[model samples]
Target: MTDQTPRLEAYQSKRSRTAVWLALGVAVITAGLVGGLLLIPRADRAEPIAVPTAFASPSAAETPAARATEAATRKVTLPAKLLSQPRLTDATLQKLADSMTLQFKDTAPETEDAVSGFYGNLAKQKLTMVIAIDAPVGNPASWASGMTHGLKTSLNAGPFHDVNPGPLGGSAKCADAKASGITIAVCLWADQETYGVLGFYYRTSASVTSDFVKARAAVELPTP
Candidate 1:
């Protein structure tokens, strides 16, 4: 019993100090939890991101390969029988020469029909004409259409007018509006029995259709 009271007092003080530390730790943990909850984001504050589609608009210019492919794939309808079957004759050649002189005012149109498949100077305003006689017959309209279409395609040009020449309205024609580089104002006149082609170059200022009409007016073809 000599120091029992002092020992009891010391133990009670130690218990009080431990209780104070425990309460301080509980307060700190509660404050940390509240702070974390306030810092969390809400759904209303967020922005939406836009998603784009895969395909885009095409460019203005087309590729060269595409143009070439388009040209290669183009269709041209030709007659069942070709107009090139006719042979050049001396009588027809004479008629052609007379027509060139009378209509075109080109009297000295040298007939290279035997070698060049045409008459007149190719260097000047020449005519590649042939009368289809004693050969297999074909559609005149179809031949004219094919000829113009071929010219338009090969030359990569336009203004080729489809015409029907002759007073009887039995022939077909295709003439250009004007003449240009490799783009002569040519007119092809084709009837059931005969067909002819007239080409104009830089040397002549005459319309191909006009020349053909004049030549037809001048010459009289024998009935087949």
Candidate 2:
């Protein structure tokens, strides 16, 4: 029982210092392992798995269908004299053409390379106005149908009937329309490259079909 309190206190201090030294040694070992792992080369490390995503193909313009469309497309042209009528002189046709062009501009703002001409005798009250628009038409039949319907609506016309497209081989329709209390023979034609409308004043569709064919031939200069 000699100095038992001091001996007990000394033993406790020694245990506490030993525990702290052991904890510090473990901490240093863990830090060294972590540093070693960080020093490993990135190339040797396992790559992250890549998640697959939806793949998009090329655009329509680059496809075969687009090339075929390009091949099928052609350009059209219009001449000064759209007909061989003797009475419809160049000067008279030019004046009428200018007027029709103005009217066309007002109505069809989206038309491109548009041309218009007038034929027949105005004095006889028998005249025809030909309007041709040069552009790419994918479906000629559909275009003709739509144009015919539009013309009928604009002119307050009656039902249109199918007409022979002649040797041009596209689509055509004729309707009898009334404008200013006068009957008008309205015809529309569409091809791959162009579309046109004809207004034959004081005439019948049967009488103007041939004229329409001729006018179409004159105006539509297909690319060779």
lDDT of 1 by residue, 17-118 (tens): 433432242223223222322232322111222224344334434333233233332211112222222222334444443443233122111111111123
Q: What total of clashing residue pairs does each candidate reach?
A: 0, 0
Over the stretch 58-78, how does candidate 2's per-residue lDDT look in tens digits?
A: 332233223334554444454
Q: Pairs clashing in candidate 2?
A: none
- Model 1 is weakest, by summed lDDT over 10 consecutive residues, at 107-116
| CA lDDT of every candidate | 0.36, 0.59
Q: Alpha carbon lDDT of residue 141, candidate 1?
A: 55
Which parts of model 2 are misplaced by more than 4 Å? 1-83, 86-96, 99-111
Model 1: residues >4 Å from true position, as ranges?
A: 1-138, 177-180, 203-206, 217-220
